[model samples]
Target chain A: MNAITIEGIEKSYGKTVQALKGITLNIPQGEFFGLLGPNGAGKTTLISAIVGLVKPNAGEIRVMGCDIRKNPTEAKKYIGLSPQDININNYMPIGKIMEFQGGFYGVSVKESRRRAEELLKYFKLWDKRKAGRYQLSGGMQRRLMIARALMGKPKILILDEPTAGIDVELRHELWTFLKQLKEKGITILLTTHYIEEAERLCEKIGIIHQGKIIACESPLKLIEQHRLHEKAERSGAFQFVRSGSLEEVFVALTGRPIEEASKKSGEEKWEALPASLL
Target chain B: MGSTTRLAALVQMEFFRFWRLLRQTIVPPVLNTLLFILIFGFSLGSRIKEIHGFPFIVYIIPGLTAMGVMNNAFSNTSTSLHMAKFDRSLDNLLAAPLKPFEMVLALVTGGIARGLLIAILTLAVALPLLKQPLFSFWLTLYFVVMQSVFFGCWGIIGALRAKTWDNLATTQTFVITPLAYLAGVFYSVTILPPPWREISLFNPLFYMVDGTRYGVLGVHDAPLWISAGMITGLAILLFAVCVWLFQIGYKMVR
Candidate 1:
């Protein structure tokens, strides 16, 4: 069974701004899926729709075989989302936050307390467990978000820019932890700006451009498929090139150069990544 | 999760925040009630000795208490719901295994909880200071709780419909404040001119304020049956609207 199945889901912000056109995809159980996209590429919108934060204009989404709209209570039971924003409650202590989240997922208070201790120490936040959200540093807050997302022991984990602000050492540590979760057969859907992170961690990658899924392939498949197609330069002194990377494939598929966007107005230029490029 | 367990956790979180920010949540209304009691009860009571044989100071306590309950209940849900949107913490709650009615219950309970606390604390501070007697305990509790729920639902609807901070401020100033003032919080509607008094009858809050007045001092402008029926009916209707808004995810979509 698929962990999440989104079928032809369309969302529009207003009359003019179509945030998502028609997105159809399925991530099977226990699969590590990565969604890579530039700014305004509908990755956040898709994630929001999956988590039921945004209602779609059309089509359907199912989480763990339960319809997200019709059976949202059951559908939501399987999802653990670490959203892009640092939206944790500043009033509650870090430990209480996790324990309360655990309670929402049917974990007993005693078991929640035990898991909170274990996860807090693992995330190096054990010392600051009593502190409120504002007391934590940026990276610590991000770590706390990840730890809290895992508190429910959810069947599917959705991480939107989960490692965006962390330092290199902690990022690697988190990667290891995520890999261990994958080994334990938990499906993970990750969206990131870092191509290297996607290549390293995700078993399959989907690249979205302007509200459309442009490609879904493994890192190696993407590399091998687009390797020889990169434009060759005969006029300049072209050096010997090795195999291509996922970053190159991403640019070749979706990126629009900045010089053209410079011709538009400031506002249009700001939105040119997926707007003018489309 | 069991539905009740989810509801309990959400309600607990709401109370936890209310306690965490005691200055913002609990202190302001209590302090406001004290100031109102001092200025209106002491200063104004010197001139106007009695209305319907009760001291001017004693006459306004129930109204003041009703206003406190209504305003606190309204602000509690309005601010809490708006903050959830401003900070995007609402996504977490929506993603949890909670039904729409559950969310409504948890949120409305938060508002009711804060409202009832303010009512109790206001009377605790005022009754002894003014030396007023409680006429009907059950009736007082009914009006307090009903008005709390009424304003609580209105707060939810306002928060959901508000697009900007200005919108919420506009509603509070033009809508809620006027309703509370026109509800006869400080004076009996009998003091108003004939037409104006009839106009005030249309204000739903009049029933609430007059109900509490009747509850506390055994004095009322309208029939007891109408006030009780109107408050209960309006509260239930507004609650149903809130549940519908949540069920449809109204005004909360992209």
Candidate 2:
């Protein structure tokens, strides 16, 4: 059975803005899956729906075979979501945060404290357990979010933009920690902007564009398909096109150039593509 | 895990947050009650002999106590929920495996805890000055708990409906505060003339204050049964509305 199954999910914001248009996907048990999407691409909305924060207008979601809408409590027990932003109680200590998170999932206080200590020591936050929230650095706070999410010992972990804004060294450290967690037979779902991050970590990548999944395949398969298409396009005389990287495949699939995102100067460059590319 | 365990955890966290700000939460209400005692109870009350059979100071103590309980209860839930929304931490609670009633119960528990603490503090300070014999402990406890629950539920509704700090404050400022002052806290409506007394009878808080007075002082303006019935009915209505709101995710989830 799959770790998560989303069938015909649809959500809309306000009157005209459709957030998720019949989103459907399946993540097999113990698989590292990545969901990539640009801003306003319904990534957060989809994550919210899965975690029961936002109710979808239509369709159903199941976590480990428990339907979310029908059996929310049972479904929620199997899943943990670490949202993109730090939405923790800022005044509480790290240890207390972990304990409360565990307790919210029905762990006894004594057991929660024991598990909290273990996780804190593993995350290297044991020394700073008593410190205030402001005392922790950005990287430490992000690490705490991961620790808190794991407090429930959830079978499936959903991380939304886990490594968005941090230095390279810290991001690498987090990646190493996440990979270790993945090795423990935990199904991990992640969303990130860094193409290389997804390429390195996620075994299956799903690129969402305008509330629809445009491509869902292994990174290598997506790169190979994009390479063949690029070769087909360069048949005339454009000789020196490098083999398409994950970034190229992402840009080609999403129809938004990464270079255009990087350029600070305001010049509208890309126009509407053919309906086929979309 | 059981739903009871999750509810307990949620309540414990709320209490932890409340007690962490002990000085801010517990001190202001005490001070406010003292000011009311000094200004109205002593100054104006000293000039006047008595409104009912009891001394003026004795007459107003229950009113002030109920007022403090109601206000603290309302603020505890409203401000905390509003801050949760402002900081976006409410999503953390939303993602947990709690039923809507469990969530509401936790918030209500936190509010009542704060409100009762303030009431105890008010009694501690007021008992020394006005040495009145106690009437019924159970009655006082019932009225205090019910009044706090009523306002706490109101606060939840306020927190959900309010989009900004000012919007939340508007209910307290424009509606609750005016009603509280006019609800026979400082002076009895029985002393007022004609239509004003009839108007004061319409305020729900008047029954709350009068009910608490019956419990504390063995004196009441309205019939004891009716006062108890009115406050209890209002509490039930407010609680039902809050539960319905939570179940529907009204203004809580988009």
For this target, which candidate reaches the highest DockQ against the unseen true structure? 2
* CA lDDT of every candidate: 0.86, 0.84
Candidate 1 local lDDT, B206-226, one digit each (tens): 999999999898999999999
Residue B103, candidate 2: C-alpha displacement in angstroms: 1.0
The TM-scores, one per candidate, come to 0.91, 0.93
> Chain A TM-score per candidate?
0.89, 0.88
- TM-score of candidate 2 against the unseen true structure: 0.93
Q: What does candidate 1's lDDT look like per residue over A1-278, in tens digits?
A: 99999999999987987888899999999999999876667889999999888888999999999998888888988988898888887668998898888888777778889999999999999999999888899999999988988888899999999988789998999999999999999999999867789999999999887789988999999988876666642112112223377777765665432122123324564776776577
Q: Candidate 2: deviation at residue B81, Å?
A: 0.7
Q: Is the docking of candidate 2 incorrect, acceptable, medium or high quality?
A: medium
Pairs in clash, predicted candidate 2: none
Best lDDT among the predictions, by candidate number: 1
